[model samples]
Target: MALATVRFDAGQPVDLEDSLLGGQAHRWKRASHPELVEGEWYSGVLRGVLVLIRQHGQAIEFLSSSSDPQAMIPRIRDHLRLDDDLKAIQAEIAGDPNVAAQVERYPGLRVLRQDPWECLIAYICSANSNIETIHRNMERLSDEFGEPLTLPNPQGEGTGTITRNAFPKPVDLAEAGEAELRRLKLGFRAPYVHQAAIAVAERRLDLAHLVAAPYQEAKAELMALKGIGDKIADCIALMSLEKMEAFPIDVWVRRALADWYFPGQKTPTNRILLEWAQRYFGRYAGYANQYLFHGRRLRDRKPAQPESG
Candidate 1:
């Protein structure tokens, strides 16, 4: 397929690497065929379509598996939330010094809008697991049950091809059974993933409806599912259910808040922290949480060492 470009308003800036490979989603990887593209390239399957994207200054160039690549512009726009006014959101949440620093540091970071069913199961597998482990688990689940696709080399006809598996549908996992999921190394999360899939596949849970529901209502519904707690529920809400104000308090966020917001005072419960964040950041509390969380993680990570000549 031919490559296509999607230009955005200058006011909207996106750091594709930080946004895609950042904690919000786990499917994307730095393109292995970087010699064929300019800037940084990422390859991932979004809602079953294999997409290759690269940041070109303020705009992005992309290639996809669709018959008409232009038809994917809307999906790509919606997925990256390209229309969100980053300047305005930063102005609203930057009142805090700590958040302001993060806003300045990672200016192009934007919240991703992921598929609700996929996001739900992804977070269900996230309980007590790190990002790398979550990626492995999700990849295993997809490989085990999803439909496989092959793409010819973008550079033109050749023997080279790329293989990927789409994220499975609810019915796929529902029928796979927990034992089969455990074989993928999902551990205790296998049952939760299975039950959640069954709920969606059987129509007992309507993930689409939650998108239009109130933030609290959507969060409550997600929390009703097994293995979903306050943090995971907020994750599903913020990333997929259109609840931008849902603040997910995890370890990194907890530490940031403790050091920056509650220095000498004892740390409050997660419930209180969530309430405080919502009240402080108002409608964009989720954005605030993401910036703080990402910033804190980057700060704690050690720098790479230089290679000797």
Candidate 2:
């Protein structure tokens, strides 16, 4: 297998851990923990390529299973959104007091530019689900239908080969009936997944055209899909289609807004919250959403301090 690698100085726009696990994408897995670096091995497949990445002090490194290793750099850069000026975006998002606190709390968090087709399906699984459920369902989809790929182990852990399934193409997934998908525990979303896969496989859902379209237009196109709603559309818009202004609101974001921004007012409608986010966070709302989301996850994971005695 062909092998390639890339590295970047630490504190760059990309934080592999935060960028992957920060609620934007759930398909990535923590492959191992090694002593050489102050980081862990992460493995993921995107657009038929398997990427194994890990970060150490002042440097992030990657190994890819693509034929042309260097060709993967552009994709990786785009995936991590390294081209964006994150420092500036952070300042812009910090306009909100709550998100400002998040900015100070989580410095390396970033929004990733994910593969659009996979991103859409992943978010479909996100509805009414926690991150753990999203991860399990997406993994099941890949394991059952997506192509299998093996990556070279730079760290030389187990057998020197790490295997994973690349996310299936629309055409492949289209062949899966909703009933079969339901068996994979997609539940009520089975039909929606089936329909979406069929639409893309049949060329009815043109993600390329949608990506080139205005943000709202692209959003409308995604919302036209079976299971996609305002939140899912914005998720795809921001992460996959390169619409930086898109802000997806989940219960966590809603709670944050209620507690921090709109105290005393009734819980705002989804439309109102979205409109308010657009106005408040402006063009980099996606980045702001990520920082806030990651911060919320961190807060939730924190162990409670002992009660004062």
Candidate 3:
């Protein structure tokens, strides 16, 4: 079967590299196929559909598995948050000089609206783990339990097919149990993922309801689950629950707050910093957090210049 293509006009600048692979979502891979060059095309599974997308100037081009590619546009839009006014959001969080620099440095980075259950489990695996580890764990979980899918290679005739796995559902994970999850190298998070999956699968936790709940309420609900702390809860709220005011304070973000906002002062607690961030950035604190966190990490990775002779 041939894949359907659609060009979506986002009406704003979008950097697919920074937005999709910049740490918000872990499933996307830079396409290695000859027809889809690295950094030009990305392949990922979204809500069970295998999607290959590329940024075409201001518009986005997509090749998806859906029979009705037109109907999937709405979902694609929501996933990428194309309707968000990037300029307005940047202006809102640009009050701080450091944050302003990040906005200027990395344009078109938007928080993805992800599936609640998937986001929850992903973050649970994120505790004390780096991005690479998280990606490995999620991939392992999906490969083991997720539904298998095959798509005609983008090259078409005689090029064979590509295979991908949909992210596993809560019922799938719950049935696998913690023992099976441990084999995936989830480590300490194995039980937590298992328990959270069981809760969602059993309907003991209503992730869908939290999407409409207030930020605090949503954070509280997520924190009540095993292995979810303030930071992870805030991540779920900001990325999935539509809580832009939720500021997650990871080590990088905490360093940003200390080095930029609270310079020369005693470092405050995560709770205190979160309060100040929400008050300072108001409804767009989460956006500010992402920019600062990503910007700081990138800055630190750069090699220092030699001292003047």
- For 9-92, candidate 3 gives per-residue lDDT tens digits of 888867888888877788888877765323467888889988888977888888777777787789888998887888899997
Q: Which parts of model 2 are misplaced by more than 4 Å?
A: 1-5, 9-11, 33-39, 155-160, 301-309
Q: On a 0 to 1 TM-score scale, where does candidate 1 land against the true structure?
A: 0.93
Ranking by lDDT: 1, 3, 2
- Residues 203-247 of candidate 1 have per-residue lDDT tens digits of 889999999999988888888888999999999999999899999
> What is the Cα-based lDDT of residue 258 in candidate 3?
97
TM-scores vs. true structure, each candidate? 0.93, 0.90, 0.94
For every candidate in turn, the CA RMSD to the true structure comes to 4.3, 4.7, 4.4
Tens-place lDDT digits, model 2, residues 105-186: 7777888888889998988888777777788899999999988887665555553576789888888778989889999999
Clashes of 3: 0
Poorest stretch of ten by lDDT in candidate 1? 300-309
Steric clash pairs (candidate 3): none
Candidate 2 overall lDDT versus native:
0.79
Query: Ranking by TM-score, best first?
Result: 3, 1, 2
